[model samples]
Target: MTQQGARWTADQVLALAPDPASRKAGSKLGTAGPWSETGSADEGTVWGLCKGSGSKPYQTVVDLADAAGPAYKCSCPSRKFPCKHALGLLLVWAGGESSLATVPEERAPEWAAQWLAGRRKRTADKAEQRAGQEARSAADPEAARRRAERRAERISAGAAELEQRLSDLLRGGLAAAEQAGYGLWEETAARMVDAQAPGLAARVRELGAIPSSGPGWPARLLEECALLHLLDQGWLRHERL
Candidate 1:
């Protein structure tokens, strides 16, 4: 079946954002004038470059047909969603700057190539591994059950530890967490990893930022906590799935 075209718009682009900082940064960079060029190739890749604040301009490229969303990398220090650079580049592309010639001779930089290759390889490997696992499970129901049980046990232990940590954080209050710094979250995340729950560990690390992230941090932290709780609950109940 054929797929639908992307509904690209400034509002749609901004809605993909998860934070206000990214929106503000995107607005700032969007004023840097029109893109030099924009275009989509036969392979479904959309590319564009726009002027940035520094001496070097920002580059943005997206595979509109890919379900994984756009790939973005910028020289900016802001860890905000899409970043200002990405937003600016997308703005130009979504506007009327998408008629540039194909530049076949322009090769990707070593770093970009390496990163892209690694991502592709990792995704391919994961798919292959999952397929293999499914095939094995189809042939061996007992083995699959044992694996599921083990995973459930590990997840349970990780959830318990995370609950304890959250309780400690609440008991001490948000101010204490700020004084504890990133090391506290890193250490907690490490513990979560050791418990075989890397996903939970990642969320824990993200939660560490709330204390130092200015006003309304409590609300943000609570939201993250609720997400973590949901993850823990889901894993505990749906391990077989």
Candidate 2:
């Protein structure tokens, strides 16, 4: 249905009733005979006081701007969501611009005003919460990107250092590796660990075992060194690959 000063028909108002009893009871009180202080405010809200059997009249209000159709509030003791009083109030408002209860007012009474204020505050709080979650969601990807870049830098530095160490080892001759023993390989692997290159560190540990493998150890050690050197070059030029 249309909103903002637009009025629903009597049939439409009754359609919102919880049951036949509510529809019937609401129709009976739809007239001006038992309603007072009735007024429609901005934002599709209508409120009024209905004379019940009690000393104090029942206060009823309807928020027509609700996305799920009209929302209702009544000071009655009924368990129904849109009680008869609220339905009756809507029916009275459905009478259109000429109805006594449809008179426009700049503000609702204290009771109605309080309910409206509470609803508005809740809605604003929910909106603010969603905005905060969205902001954090937006920041998370950027933080992840920075972390990845930092890791890449560490790996590249490790690879370059490894390449230089391989060059020095080859210049010093393959015979020097056997004399250097496991200590040289262990120290280099530890350096790779500091650089956050676990794969390189593992390969370095494997190289340390080759010197003790027996028979043609020099050829095996040279082959492993060639492979490790190729891996270091690949990492240093990863962007091109």
- Stretches of candidate 2 off by over 4 Å are 1-5, 97-106, 141-241
**Candidate 2 TM-score to native:** 0.54
lDDT of 1 by residue, 57-76 (tens): 55655543333334566555
Question: When superposed on Cα atoms, how far off is each prediction in RMSD?
Answer: 8.0, 29.6
Per-residue lDDT of 104 in model 1: 36
Q: Which digits, one per residue and each the tens of the lDDT, describe model 2 over residues 151-189?
A: 899999988888988899999998777666555776787
Location of the lowest summed lDDT over 10 successive residues in candidate 2: 97-106
TM-score of every candidate: 0.50, 0.54
> Whole-model lDDT for model 1 versus the true structure?
0.62
